[model samples]
Target: MLIDEAYKSRILRGEKTTTIRFGEYEAKPGSEVYLVITPSDTAVAKVRITNVERKKVKELTNQDAKKDGFKDVKELVKALNKIYGELHGEDEVTVIEFEVVEKFESGIPLKWLKGLNYRNPEEIAKLYIENNLKDSPDVDLIIRKVYSEGLKEAVRRYGPKRVRDALLKAYHKLYADGKI
Candidate 1:
């Protein structure tokens, strides 16, 4: 879920407990959410949904408005109208009430990744193959892990195609070098 910087800070400070969005929310109650701060694109906290309510805009009460960081129903409606543009009081909105479960550092810290010991995809593939050679060898799992986790930052920096190509090249190189 995304929020502006001001609201993100409030959520982190345990001031905001509810978020109102202009549509039906897909997340079920009890599901965890990573609140991404917009403009910065940094995930700062994790929250668990305690309740989710779908109701018309006009149905919001003062309590609901307070949970959403508004002083009262009028202010909440005004803010909603400004963001949504001409909201008919009848427009549906999803009120997601959550509790912050944990706070996270700004971004993926390079320091922690460095501790993993593998610098690139080739090293990752090499380690995976070596570790699983005596057991069940699942190259697909290594590929998936690399694509999803190891190369996440790279994918964000250089784009998916480039990162994928590089990973494939490294995997093939293992066979070429007769290391697997």
Candidate 2:
């Protein structure tokens, strides 16, 4: 994921050109530089920018870059971060915890949860799907909404500890149902 020093050069003093690419990437050139976006969606596709030396990479004006004392990339990046302190701030993002309040079959909520919410949405959703997929595929419709990618995103947003705890609870439920 890091292109690093593998693609950098000062073509003409004070200006630099950096060529970047990954495996199976297309090559392109332009008045400036061409950025190629991959076509596939499910593969976490990669893109490549080739032949940058023949072109000059664009630079921001001093007035634009230094408005907040941002002299370079590091300063600009630091300034972009609005966080000072606190677990999360106004501009910061937090993982929202989702719970299953109850189960449903044929659009009717069940008392299976005993009025308690499950900490893990995936576990609850998985169980609901597994149970419903037997009688009616309609009840399992929400399963697709809870994708592996979505659950992984939740794992990334929340720490591994929380994700693992939820996963364990889900596993326990699966075990109880003899579906593990």
Candidate 3:
């Protein structure tokens, strides 16, 4: 049969392959996901944007894009802003909202000085009950590391009281009796 011959030929030609679109990613309330792909390939990657209501941040990888883990806002902001600077002149980016859409209750602590629009308590509580996050230990570890490093600058900016209150507010909003 022609179909059998075609299948045999495909097998013999090493054409067996698996499709791998990026899997579903869960971004915690006090977190976000940045798609870092080749600048040349960003438009293609952007097409795969499935969640329109959920804000997505675009972080163009460096010309020499490596798989290094970003540590904190200080480091990520410094590096990512540099990427923005480089692309500002070279590429014509049409849209960039640069918004904080969500923040987890038990996420990286910050004063939220600028008070960018963020996902509120109810949405986050829903996400928590649903257990949408991957439930990976690395997620908490990364959040803690990023929070400690980022909160230092925020405290210096907004003072310790505001930072403490903001963190306490988040806690109280989630757990009224401080039983976390």
Q: How many residue pairs clash in each candidate?
A: 0, 0, 5
Pick out the ten consecutive residues of candidate 1 with the lowest summed lDDT: 109-118
Per-residue lDDT over 1-180 for candidate 2, one digit per residue giving the tens place of the 0 to 100 score: 112221112221213223222112333432222111123111111223323222111232343334323466444334334333322122322111111122211111112122214223455556645654332342233333443444546445664455444444454555577764
Q: Give the TM-score of candidate 1.
A: 0.60
Error of 2 at 106 (Å): 35
Best by TM-score: 1
Q: 1-180 in candidate 3: lDDT tens per residue?
A: 001122222222324111111122232332333222232211101112222222112333321122112333344335435544432223322221122223222332212321312333233334333442322353333323334545445456666565544544443444543333
Per-model TM-score on C-alpha atoms? 0.60, 0.22, 0.18
Residues 1-180 of candidate 1 have per-residue lDDT tens digits of 778877877787777899998878776899886677777766566689999999998899999999998899899889888887877778899999999987764342223223332234535555545544322233354455554555555556666565455455454555456654
lDDT-sorted candidate list, best first: 1, 2, 3
Worst 10 residues of 2 by lDDT: 103-112
Best by lDDT: 1
Q: What is the lDDT of residue 82 in candidate 2?
A: 34
In model 3, pairs of residues that clash are: 29-102, 29-103, 29-104, 30-103, 30-104
Error of 3 at 111 (Å): 17
CA lDDT, candidate 2, residue 68: 21
Q: Model 3: runs farther than 4 Å from truth?
A: 1-149, 177-180
